[model samples]
Target: MTADPKSSPLFSFGVPALFVWLWSTGFIGAKYGLPYAEPFTLLLIRMLLTLVLLGVLARLLKARWPGWRGAGHLAVTGLLVHGCYLGGVYYAIQGGMPSGIISLIVGLQPLVTSAVAIMVLNEKVSVRQWLGLVLGLVGVCLVLLEKFGLNDTSGGFPAWTLIWAALSLGGISLGTVYQKRRGTGADLVSGTIIQYMAAASFFAVGAFAFETREVEWALPLVLSMAWLVFGVSIGAILLLMWLIRRGAASQVASLFYLVPPVTALEAFILFDERLGLLAMAGGCLSIAGVAMVVMRPPPVNKQ
Candidate 1:
């Protein structure tokens, strides 16, 4: 008996599913992480610690470092995925937009990534993917519309929230495209460690330059910071790298569409947020669309 290549390793898809779930929970992670430390300071420390942890892990595993040539390539990844995108989103969440809203909005990353892939990566997408993109957009729109209540006073969120959300999506799409064009330089552990450190550096620099308000001290805050470090940065990233390494980029990114709904579900379950009609519908639509687009197997290699 022989293994079927058509299976494409269930773990590849499985890992991304878990990755999105954890990512959905990242809102909770950020919400908890921010109270104790400034955003920049928090991100900075998270990256630094991740780098150290990865370094030790690599050393034990006898990891190979790609050295300086790899560093430049890694820097770009850090900037888009970690620095601009994450930095913008975290600060926005800290600034006040709800995590659910942000996830719903950021869910557009796959659609954007698809467009970019067509234009830049020269990757061919099926009509199904385009349909999926539209359906996903509608779902996102439903989620956004729910944010409004009939009340007239303060009836809307800060305009900047949209800007920040867009920035986050834009960064991620650009980052994905960049990765497709330029494969990573260092090994997963090393790549992540370096990428995170770069992001952390940006945050640290920002904290020193801009943060002014006093931060509260407490156990929850300490725990939150630790969670961001070990849980989100370390845990989630490794899972992400695993998925990317094992699966096609389209297949891997499609999993991100699941993040919003799953995160919303978690928020409702754990945080007592409402599971509204819009959220439910949007979740379904987004999932369906993503599946259609991602599940379409890439053109079979010609013999």
Candidate 2:
């Protein structure tokens, strides 16, 4: 008998929603987590804790590890996606690039991923998806222009911040394509442990070399660390891995397009940041682009 499709309906759609929610909350978690520990140091701790918890969870579920075969690929994936991408983002935020602007910058990831996929994955993207990508790019520019005035509060997007943001976006885009290029079917839990461990190594070196990271052990700091370990490292990363395994990488990444608006909402409530209607308009554009791209039919096989 023909086996059930890999992406059964119940799990497939729900995965994206979970990915969005886990990722959305992570922005706030980062805001809380990074202030206490240095950026690279915090990431190392998160990655370290992520692997530990993933191992336990995997053992509980008896999830089979992919063994050494997938190790190198997972290592490279983690270095690019988590290590470089998050390292840059955290560095930028540490320099006072507002989370909204950070969102706008990193939020363009879906469009960038599409471009990389075209070259790397040889994925067929329809003209409609192309238009959606264009819209997303325009939306990102609008959000940046409207909110992050040319001269930001913190030294007007230092040269390093701009370059780091670009590299971060590139890392994420390349990671998306790489994941597709490598193909997915390995056990998600086992795969994530490898990825986190890889990221942990990169960040550990960064932490030891560059950062003072002499953080005092306070109750709030310790609590924030726990939240980040659970919320972002374990929750967001695992959901992302599962989604990539189950569906189109680009389609899975569309949910990340929601991160900008969700982050804005959280910023407003938590940080007392203002997001005017114009900013919200840009958010709507991003949401529209995501809808257009993800719902489009897959490319047909040529006769």
**Candidate 2 global CA lDDT score:** 0.75
Q: Give lDDT: candidate 2, residue 177.
A: 70
Q: What is the lDDT of candidate 1?
A: 0.72
For model 2, the superposed segments whose C-alpha errors exceed 4 Å read: 1-13, 150-155, 297-303
Q: Lowest lDDT 10-mer window, candidate 2?
A: 148-157
| lDDT agreement with native, every candidate | 0.72, 0.75
What tens digits encode model 1's per-residue C-alpha lDDT throughout 168-211?
Answer: 88888787677656645468877776677777777778888988
C-alpha RMSD for every candidate: 3.2, 3.3
Model 2 clash count equals 0
Model 1 scores worst on lDDT over the 10 consecutive residues at: 147-156
lDDT of 1 at 136: 69
lDDT for position 237 in model 2: 78
